[model samples]
Target: MNWLGWLHDFFTDPAHRSGPDSVLNRLLEHLAFSAEALALAALIALPLGLLIGYWGRGMFLVTALTGVARALPTLGLVTLTVLLAGVGDAAVLVPLTALAVPPLLVAAAEGVRGTDPDTRDAARGIGLTHPQTLFQVCVPAALPTLLAGFRTAAVQVIATATVAAYVGQGGLGRYVIDGLATRNFATTAGGALLVVLLAVAVQLLFSLLIRYASPRGARTGLVDDPAGSPALLKESV
Candidate 1:
């Protein structure tokens, strides 16, 4: 059969549409795995980034370490994780979370660190505490960069989550791996297409977020109106 014919069969195949191993189930599994890894990466990277950025300390070191982490091979990390932890979610999570951290950590640190010094001073002059200044001023200003990092990490994780199938975990990658192993061109194409579509959807979602969270957007009252922080500070005082 031609490539189109295989895709048609792959899509029409009732076996691919239902049951535990169905496309729908595997797609959900892929999303779940990506979400878990992204969450873990954010949980580890965000607070640490914020604290260091706020203090202007260790940001360089952290970014350097995560940069090295980014250079490590994802499949190698997964294999090592599997060997040590045994095959399960941990094997998938360890590598993907590591894959996700560099961008997130760097973006978080730089975003917060890049906050306008004048804005910080004004916030402090208005009697805002350090924590308040960080949250209300730095965080709001950092939204664009932070969201971009999240979007990048999210797309990377979704694309790489297929490795889950390598360790006997269920995900859309299963179709690709199984298809290639069995020389089922239709399944491989169909599975790859689904992943691309998913990554595109995430990219669009984050684009909307970054646009609206931007300073220009906030000035236009698009987001929470972070541009009006001075007025809010006066009100608080």
Candidate 2:
């Protein structure tokens, strides 16, 4: 059948539409896989990133690791992981975590490095402990950049999670793979569309979350409000 006919059949076919292995189930499975992978990756990468960035030590090793991580292709990593860890969900998590680390680590390092020296000195002068300075001061300052990195990682994980289906893990990608196996163009196209939609939705959610968590100053880009004075009053009034 032609593309249009296939799409019509896909939507209208009762047999295809009414089952446990339907499109909706596959999409939900895909979302679950992506979310779990991203959450796990964030839990692992974020703390390590914060430590490496905030403490200003281990920068070299962290950078090197992140660089190596970035260089590894998702497919290749997944292949190796499957060989070592065997198939199933474990195979998916290994590569997804690897995919997530670089952006998180870089963001963290940059966030810590970008923190103003004066602010650090001021915190130190107040006799704040290193951990206090890190959590209370440096992290707050670096939040915007860090959030940007987090968003990047989230999007990356979602896109790559489809690979899990290739190894017999259930996801929307099953549609695409199954379609190819059976020469069903509609399933493949529909699956690809679903993956794109999933990525966009995840990205939007994360962007909103970052904005909600960001400091007012970071969101507004005005570190401090202008002083009230006659000249300023004249300009406004």
Candidate 3:
């Protein structure tokens, strides 16, 4: 069959749709894996990032770590992690979490840093403590950028989570790996298409969240300055 025919067959295959190892199941696994990694990354990155942005301390640390983390080979790190932890979700989580942190850290720090200096000064003048100013003033102002960062991280994690199948974990990637082994280009193409669709969905979801949920100032920072946000993400990535 031709490639399009393969995709149609892959989609129409009832066996691929309903079983425990079905595409739906694998997609759930993919989402779950990405979620876990993002949560872990947020825990590691957010507080430190907030502090760094608030105090203007450790930007070098953030920059150095972001660069080093991005440069780390995902497959090699996965291999080393599996060697150390011995094949399971933990092995996968370590590398995925690492993959996730740089964007989150950069976003958090940058969002907070992007807060208007005049607003910050006014808050300080009004007797807001440093912590109060950050939480009440800066955080609210930075909400949109923070959400945009998560959008970027989510897309990255979703695309990369396909690697889970490499460590014997179940996910959308299994189709690609298994199909490739069997010379089923159709299944491989379909699997890849699914990942792309999921990433786009995530991008759209975050865009909506940033639009309707964030403060006007926060939304303005993201929506009004299209060039700035991408540049920031580009630098981080």
Candidate 4:
């Protein structure tokens, strides 16, 4: 059958909709794995990032770690972990966590740094403590940048979570891997669609979240043009 025919079968088939190895189950697994990694990354990156940005310290550490993460190939890292640690979820999770961290860290740091200094000073003028200035004053101003980083990391994690299947774990990738092994091109194509759809969904979800969560100035696009809205950061504060 052609692509259109396969797609119809892929979506309509009851087996794909329900069963232990169903597409839905695999998609859930994929989501779970990606969420786990992203959560861990956020836990590690957010506090450190917030502190680094607030203190204007650890820039070198963040930059170096981010650079190393970006330079490391995902497939190679996954494979190496599997070889060194032996095949299992750890093989996949470690590398995936590594893959997810950089964006979160960068966003956290940049958002903190990008705050309007005058706004920060004004916050200080109000007798807000250091912690208060960082959280109440600066963090809100940095929301746009932080949200952008979060969205990027989420999309990437969803796309890459397929690596789980290679390590004998479940994920949307199972379809692709199994299909390829058995030469079932339709299943492989369907899996690809699922991954892409999930990634898009994540992006859309974050966009809406950012829209509602953002200060009005940022939602209006002032965040994109720093010079155009010098006061917007202060307004955010």
Candidate 5:
């Protein structure tokens, strides 16, 4: 059958509706795996980024590390972690979390640092304490970019979570792996379609968040370094 025919059958397949490897089950597994990794990445990266960006400290270190992380070979890392971690979700989780961290960490730092100097100073001058200004002033201002980065990372994690199947963890990726192993073109295409759709949905969700949550007032047009901070853009210092 053609790709379109296979996709149609994939959606209509009764087996996909119920059972251990059902569509619902694989989707849940995929979401859980991706969400867990993303949550951890956010917990670690956001606070550190906010601190460093607010203080204008550790720019080099944070950017350098994130860059290195994004460059790492995800498949290779998963393989190596499985060798040491010894199977189960740990193998996939380690690399998946690693994959999700870079964009969040870098964007968060850059977003915070990119806050207009005037806006930050005004917040401070108005008796907004450091914590107050950090949370109220800076976080709001930095949110659009932060969300943008998060969107990238989250979608990436969701798509990449399919690799979990390699370690015997069930996800939509199982269809792809099993299909390829058995030379079942329909299952492979269907799984790839589901993953792509999920990624697009994640991106759409973040876009909505950026639209709604972005600050108003001075944050309207060129507000808060729309591109990024001069500090972030600079090669050094």
Candidate 6:
């Protein structure tokens, strides 16, 4: 089939359309796997990162360990996990979670560490407790950077989740693998394109969510004015 006809068929073929076990269904499943793994990793990594980065304790050790985790190749890690856990989603989950942790940890830690000392001191000066300072002052300040880390982890997981098919877990990767087995280039290309589109959509959605959740001052890069301070135009006049 010509490229244009292939595109039309991909979109219009009733069997290929969104349904149980359809391309869209597989894409959603892949996304679900990515989300669940990353969410679990975030729950674990975020608090640990906050403690290490904000308190400046065990930062070195945690950072070092995460670096080592990140250094392990995704394929190698997945293979090892399959060897131990046996094939299926468990095998894929182990490696994707491992791949996700490093970015989350590093971003959270760096975000906390990167908070301005003056701002932190000001929060302390207000008689806030250590936890309050970390949560209210430091975390809000570092949200953008932390979100960037999340974006990175999310995209990586989505792309890598396709590897699940190699271990007998069905995903969009099934189409690719099956295509290759039957020498069907069209199916392989279609599946690959769907994966790419899904990844892009997820990235864009998360980026927008991060921006929306960021504080107005942070999003605009404007410093907070003290109460009773004149408005900028009034002060200028």
lDDT of each: 0.84, 0.74, 0.84, 0.82, 0.82, 0.76
lDDT (10s digit) by residue, model 1, range 140-162: 89887788788888999999999
Show where candidate 4 strays beyond 4 Å. 222-237
Instruction: Report the C-alpha lDDT of model 5 over 98-121, residue by residue, as the tens digit.
Output: 888877887788888888899989
Better of 1 and 3 by TM-score: 3
Ten contiguous residues minimizing lDDT sum, candidate 4: 225-234
Least well predicted 10-residue stretch by lDDT in candidate 1: 228-237
The parts of candidate 6 lying over 4 Å away from their true place are: 1-3, 214-237
Candidate 6 per-residue C-alpha lDDT over 1-237 given as tens digits, one digit per residue, 9 for 90 to 100: 776666665566676775665877887778778988898889888999888889877878776868797788878877888888777677888888887887788778877987889999999999999999999999988776677678778888888888877887778887777778887767777777888887898778766766665665556442221111211211110
Write down the TM-score of every candidate.
0.89, 0.82, 0.91, 0.89, 0.89, 0.84
Tens-digit per-residue lDDT, 92-194, candidate 4? 8888899888888988887898888999899899899999999898888888777777788888888988888888999999988988999988888888898
lDDT against true structure, model 2: 0.74
lDDT of 5 at 30: 92
**What is the per-residue lDDT of model 2 for residues 47-154, given as tens digits with 9 covering 90 to 100?**
887887777788888768877888898888888888988887888888888888777777777777778899999999999999899899998887766766767777
Clashing pairs in 5: none
Backbone clashes for every candidate come to: 0, 0, 0, 0, 0, 0
* Global Cα lDDT for candidate 4: 0.82
Superposition error at 61 for model 2 (Å): 2.2
Query: Where does candidate 6 clash, by residue pair?
Result: none
lDDT of 1 at 84: 96
Q: How far off is residue 204 in model 4, in Å? A: 0.9
**Global CA lDDT computed for model 5:** 0.82
Candidate 3, residues 1-237, lDDT tens digits: the string is 777898898898887879876888989999999999999999999999899988888899998988999999889998999998899998789888999898889888888987889999999999999999999999887777788778878888899998998999988999999889999887898899899999999988887777765654434442322113452222111
